[model samples]
Target: MAGCFDVMQHNASFDWDTRRNTYSAIFAGFLFFFAWWLVIDTAVVFTPTGDWNNWYFALAVSCSLSMFMVNSVSNRALEGLYSEEGVLGVKGTRIWLMFGFIGSFACIIAGIWIMFGDYVLQKNDNPKWPGVAIFLHTLLTFIASLTYKFGRSEELWD
Candidate 1:
């Protein structure tokens, strides 16, 4: 039953710092902010070439929604199957979180595809930074999300 919940438990012997939770949260927050910063820079540095250009900014929106999906579930929801607290049972919660992870990963892959296919592969005068920036945004967000989810001290909150 522990499966995914294994990391939720505290391990004092492996701890590098007494403030592990605080540090993990700070790192996660920085990553999240940096992710948005990169995407916003993409939005600012590049003007819309046309309605099609709007897809660049749309990636940010999609990443944000997917981030919400990943972070929306509580750790406890997955820890207890028989508990009456969550409306969604353990299986449902697991599925919801799974979809979230999938969405986030998909966003990053799409960003990579756009970077190479649209900018790198093409011989247009357009700079490659925009594509790279978008990819960074999605990748950073995905890393930040997983870090926030798994890096925190679950027992501290309990």
Candidate 2:
């Protein structure tokens, strides 16, 4: 058991100049775990005893997944902005970055829209956990992506 633990620690000890990647990865993992738990808890374990169908679970899952995908794509697209040379040239790189920014904002807006339209409007008297979870997931996804993108900066105040 000690040998196994030593091997695991050795494998995990990689040189990282900054803590952004580690922090972002941790945050993303936590967000995903929380989302999974929330869905399982609400949809399966603690479900209200009825024949009712709660669509919020599906919506929350979809929104969280979409936010993650959008963040990933945007992060990849941002690579072009930092490259010294690209096949598509500087203009194309700028375009890619612009599109990525737009997509990120669009995902955020969509999350807000779903929260307001599905939860706030429908359950005005009693707001539920699903909407809040989706919103928090979206925000976390955005922060994680930004952290990954800007984490490599050599600036004094990063």
Candidate 3:
């Protein structure tokens, strides 16, 4: 909310510019959508199930909706860092990141456990094709976003 930031800034006696404020909100919206594109949309490729498990797509759509919520909360937070107002904090944004981080990890862990499961079941002759490698690769893309910035913001200068 603008008031939240306004209250904080006013209490600190810092002058906030309306132009910068406008830009920050706009930038937050941009990053929220971009992050969805990079992370959630990528996840969708893995879920082609015809049923409701189409959640990967739902997640992507929800991430887009949250863009507005994130802007309403205040935009600057989403522009640069991973703090509260950041794109990462928006409900959908946070969910997608979690899905990518935890969901991907769960898939990887399951794949590994399956390998052991197969071994114990005396199916050792079976190839180690649990699909773990693919899951890991997807998760790594998310991690890569941390080191590599991929969105544009008015605050960012070349």
Candidate 4:
């Protein structure tokens, strides 16, 4: 069984990082739309709470914060991997990759909140299972993205 698993394993490489970056950017865009859907649903459900415009504002703020975090992380990663000349050439592009991961995380979180809050208030929902599902999905997706370059390599804590 271990041998079978080893046969299918992948390893870290620059090529792998490049592929991951493409996928990351695509997913990030998906997250932006996902957040939009959630906010719209929330406002529609809770129109009595106030005007619908505020929910869009919340979504915008969350995405903006996420982009800031993404840029910060990407900047560090680029600095570590490239020389100053390389960094100058690529830094602007790297920011997009960071934006993807951060945006995905933010959208997933907001989606959970919007979907569950109204469910609980209007449908007498119990959120224990749904909450766990949301958490695990978010965590697993994040870990998967972060480790895409490492492939099958396992990291152990000392």
Candidate 5:
């Protein structure tokens, strides 16, 4: 009950670190959950013949991989605070981060391709929900990863 009032207040401010972190985490979690829910529900509810293949899950899978690549290194490490001790140096972190961004963008491009090449351009009796779900999965997961990675202030934590 007390927690409900705390979350219900519209006058919340980022000045409160715990509040900011809580809100960001909640928002990111909601987006991720909703995205997966939509994709899975669409896949199950609108299963067409021979068209609903494994390729539809590529977007979500790639997004998860990208998130791992991007966030596996801590912000302190990226900032060169622990350059000498880690197996992956600052340069390696940068390289991984770069590839993560690349993979993230690639998945989005693939989503677009699935939406157009598979569903839009294909002249079949298949439902278009798969394509749309794939695209939304990529987009929402990317956004959620960004939110979880950047929205919190880890600099304050030890």
Candidate 6:
């Protein structure tokens, strides 16, 4: 048992320098899990009896995941921005970065709009848990991406 535990610990160990990456990944995982939970809860537990549309919840999940992917890809591209020898010119890199940021921002805005227009404004007396969950998921995705980006830095913020 001790031997097995030691092996497991060794495999799970992460370098201190990459702790931020681990944390951001964990946060992303939690966000995805919560999003899934929200969807399932809405479907199984809180079956909408009114004229509620399911598209809003779906859109929220899609937007959150899409934002995360775009931000990650753009961040990887931006890493090559300062490289003078790269095939992608600095101008191209900047363009990609700008597009990625815009897409991410758009996703957040869309999530908010869905939450407000679908759940908040509805005339139902049902709990607004789904909308709240989606909004939190979108916000957490944004935060996780920012954490991944800034966590790469080793400098102390003075």
Q: TM-score: which candidate is best? A: 5
Each model's number of backbone clashes? 0, 0, 3, 0, 0, 0
Pairing residues by index, what is the TM-score of model 2?
0.53
Candidate 2, residues 47-150, lDDT tens digits: the string is 46431236555555555554444444333344544445546565665565566656656666766876676567783455456556556655665665565555
- How high is the lDDT of residue 130 in model 5? 79
- Model 1 regions lying over 4 Å from their true place: 1-18, 48-52
* Ranking, TM-score, top scorer first: 5, 1, 6, 2, 4, 3
Clashing pairs in 5: none
Off by over 4 Å in 6: 1-18, 47-52, 73-87, 153-158
Colliding pairs, model 4: none
Error of 2 at 57 (Å): 9.2
How does each model score on lDDT? 0.79, 0.55, 0.40, 0.49, 0.80, 0.62
**After superposition on all CA atoms, what RMSD does each candidate show versus the true structure?**
10.9, 7.3, 16.7, 10.4, 4.6, 6.4
> What does candidate 5's lDDT look like per residue over 1-158, in tens digits?
66777666485446656666777778889998988897888777766555567657767877878977876767887888873758878888888899998998998898888888888777867778778888888899889889878887775676
Ranking by lDDT: 5, 1, 6, 2, 4, 3
State how far residue 34 of model 2 sits from its true place (Å). 4.9
Candidate 5 residue runs with Cα over 4 Å from true position: 1-16
Candidate 4 stretches greater than 4 Å from native: 1-20, 49-60, 75-79, 85-158
In candidate 6, what are the lDDT values of residues 58-147, reduced to their tens digit? 666665555555554444455553445366565676675566567667777877876787679888676676667667666766665665
lDDT string for model 3 (42-115, tens) is 34543453211333334334333333332233224333354455444666554554454454345445434543
Stretch of 10 with least lDDT, candidate 5? 9-18
